[model samples]
Target: MKIVVAGGTGFLGRHISRALLDAGHDVTVLGRSPDKVSAIPQLRGATATKGDVTDPGTLSGRLEGAEAVVQAVQFPNHPIELPRKNLTYDRYDRQGTINLLSEAERSGVGRFVYISGAGADAASEKTWYRAKGLAERALIGSGIDHAIVRPSWAYGPEDRALNRFVQIARFSPVLPQPGAAPQRIQPVYVGDVARSVARVFERAAWNDVYEVGSREVMTMNEVVHTLLDVMGKKRAVLPIPSGLLKMATAPLKALPTPPMTPQGIEFATQDGLVDITKMVQVLGVEPLSLREGLTRYIER
Candidate 1:
């Protein structure tokens, strides 16, 4: 199978690219900076092409001779939108996939795989979920044979979320919890997400959306405690008051690449509910447990 993976240099996309390559598929990584593809170890054996999904003109002939196309692109700092720089979900997640889908259709692609979020809702007011929901809706309406794989808080060595906490735990005696509320989340391993996307091709007639996540649904406090245990570190879990964090992330809205925004703070605290019935039954992918996933990436 000849497949073109948009944003193959990204965290999730790189894993998907490697999984497909290991499965004997001819993979071509499409990104704005194809030269940086060499820096990503997972994209080592894959071909690189200069194409930005945000710019549809660059996508011309990129998906040619490709049997499948995967939309796994993310902005400069994922989950943290820099609207001033036009790096929001509306631009990349929503418009980017739409643009890539247009090119995929023109290139005669057979299958499309979209990496959607766990609680994506087109009608929602949230930016990330709404963007993903609109893109999913577009893909379904495109009348293309596509599989939507919605991962639940995917974390890995290269991930920005959980790794940020891990990095804090290594240097500080107290691990700062995002919010005081028990924001439930099912953290899935990046490898499991990659595997799920790759397994989508193994089955026939998979046009439906599949949600993938671990068996454990834990709170933010539990997640960090478990992550600490996996890293063989003992730290006090200190919950930051939501009001204080919200006030602190206010000034970040003005930065070029804001590390944390007011919206991002809310996004981090939201519950990520997932149902893996189709993931296991249809795709035959059972995501790793949160503890198992943390152990795989965080060294003890």
Candidate 2:
């Protein structure tokens, strides 16, 4: 099978490309930066094409002659100063997804896999979730054979998700956790996610959405503490009022991708557990536990 993974230079995308290659499928990664794609050894054997999904014209030729298409793109370094209301979630998450779907359909791709986050809501007030929801809807409506895989709190070496917290813990003597720090999350290993995508292809899963996550449902504090324990550092965790933390990070909104946007804070405080039954049933592969995954990169 010839597969094209959009945004394949990204943290998750890179791993997914490798998994596809390992499965003996011809893989091609289409992304905004072809240079970054060249850096990955797995992708070196696979094709790398430079294109932007937001601008369909640039990606027209890139999607041609592909059996399957996977959209793994995200707008990471966009302006954080832009309020959620004014953010380009529609432009990037929603429209960009639609653009990819249209191209895939035009190219007669057999399967379209959309990588979305858990808890995405089409009717939500939150821009991020709403945009993802919109993208999900667009894929469902595109009449292209599609599957949506929603992952919860993915982490690995190149992960930007929990690395933000790790960076804070490295610098500060105290780590500020939101609320009671008991908000639970099922952190899925990136390798598991990559393998799941490959398995989905191998099994020919079509028109189904599955959530990928690990076995352990750990609290926010436990996650931080585990990282600290792995790093062999003792950092006192202080539970700051959500309001206070939001206020403190508000000034830093002028930068691209603020560490603590209100929406991000909301996402962080909530339980991010997912129903892994479907993923297990369809993919037929066991996902790695959080502790097992953290050990790979967690330095002593």
Candidate 3:
């Protein structure tokens, strides 16, 4: 099978691209900067193409002869940097996906795999979730064989979420948390996410939505403490009220490169747990535990 992966230069996208290549399929990575594709070691075996999902014109004829298309493009800043560089979830996630789907349908692509988040819902107030929900709806209604994989919080060596926590723990004696509420999350390993995505190409996975996550569910405080423990550091966790934390970080939003944002704080405090039975059974993958996955990077 010939597969085209949008945003294949990104952390998760590269992993999925590599997995498809390992399965003996031809893979093409589509991104804004095609030249930088060679810089990523994981994308070594796959070819790269210059295409941007935001601009539908750039994606013309990119899907030709491709049997499947994986919608993996996302705004790198995400909830942390809203409207950064004039990029938002609406423009990137929702509209970008619609553009890709339009091209895929025109090019006779049979399978469409979308990487959605755990809390995706059209009616959700959260910006990211709403955008993803709208994209998933578009893919389902596109008259294409589609599989939507809604992954919980994913983490790895190159991950921004856990790696940021580890970086902060190395320098600070105090770790600030959003609230006392046990914001639970099942952190899935990036490798498992890649394998699940690869499995979507199989005939059994078509027209289905799978929620991927590990077996362990940890609270927000537990996630931070675990990172501190893995890094061989001890930090006092201060759970401040969500509103106060947002207000405190409000001024940083004005900086050219703000370290944090209110939307990011809200995402951190929300519960992101998911049921992984479908991911395990259908994808035939057993995800690594939180400790096992974290230790792989932090201990290095």
Candidate 4:
């Protein structure tokens, strides 16, 4: 099968590209920067094509002769700030997906796989989740064999979520958690997500949405402590009031690249748990626990 993975240079996209490549499928990574494809070791085997999903014109001819299309493109800095060129969730995730689906449908693509986030709902107040929900709806109604894989908070060596916490723990004697409330999350391994996506294509699970995640759920506090343990460091975790943290970082949003934003804090504190029964039964994958997954990157 000839597969085109949009945003294939990203963390999870690269993993998915590798999984498809290992399955003996011809893979093409469609992204804005074709040069960055070599940076991700997993995508070395994939043919890189430069294209911006935000611009429908650039997507033309990219999907030609492609049997399957994977909508993995996302705004790099999500939930924090708008991307350069005024790209928002609606423009990138929602409209970008619509553009790709349009081109793929024109090319008579057989399969369309979308990487949606957990807790996504068309009626949700959150912009990110709402955009993903809209995109999922578009894919299902596009008259193509589509599979939507909604993965929980995914983490790996190159992950921004847990890895940011690890970087903070490295320098800070005390780590600061957002809020005192127990924020539940099931952090799925990136590799597990990739394998599940591959299975979706191999099995041709059309018009279905699979929530992929780990079995165990942990709180924000627990996740931070576990990372500390994995890093072989002991840092007193201070659960600061969410309001105060947001107040402090409110001005940072003005910067081109803010380290943290209030919206990001809200997303961090929210519950991200997901039921993985279908991910196991359908995809035949048992995702690694938070501890086990963390151990792979953090040296004890």
Query: Who wins the TM-score comparison?
Result: 1
> In terms of lDDT, which candidate is stronger, 1 or 3?
1
lDDT of 4 at 72: 90
- Winner on TM-score between 1 and 2 is 1
- Name the better of 2 and 3 by TM-score: 3
For residues 1-300, write the lDDT of model 1, one tens digit per residue. 898998898889999999999988999999999999988888889999999899999999889889999999988876788777788999998999999999999999988999999999999898899999999999999998999989888899898888889889889998889899888888889999999888887666369998988888988898888888898999999999777898998997887777788888888888998999988888888778988777776788
Clashing pairs in 2: none
lDDT of 2 by residue, 146-239 (tens): 8899998899988876787778877899887776747778899999999889888888888888899987888878888888887778999887
Q: Per the 3 Å backbone cut-off, how many clashing residue pairs does candidate 4 have?
A: 0
- lDDT against true structure, model 1: 0.89
TM-score computed on alpha carbons, candidate 4: 0.95
Q: Better model by lDDT, 2 or 3?
A: 3
Candidate 3 C-alpha error for residue 150, in Å: 0.6
Task: List the candidates' TM-scores in order.
Answer: 0.97, 0.91, 0.94, 0.95
lDDT of 4 by residue, 128-242 (tens): 8898899999988888899999998889988877887788899999887888888888989999999999999777777888998889888889888888988899999999878
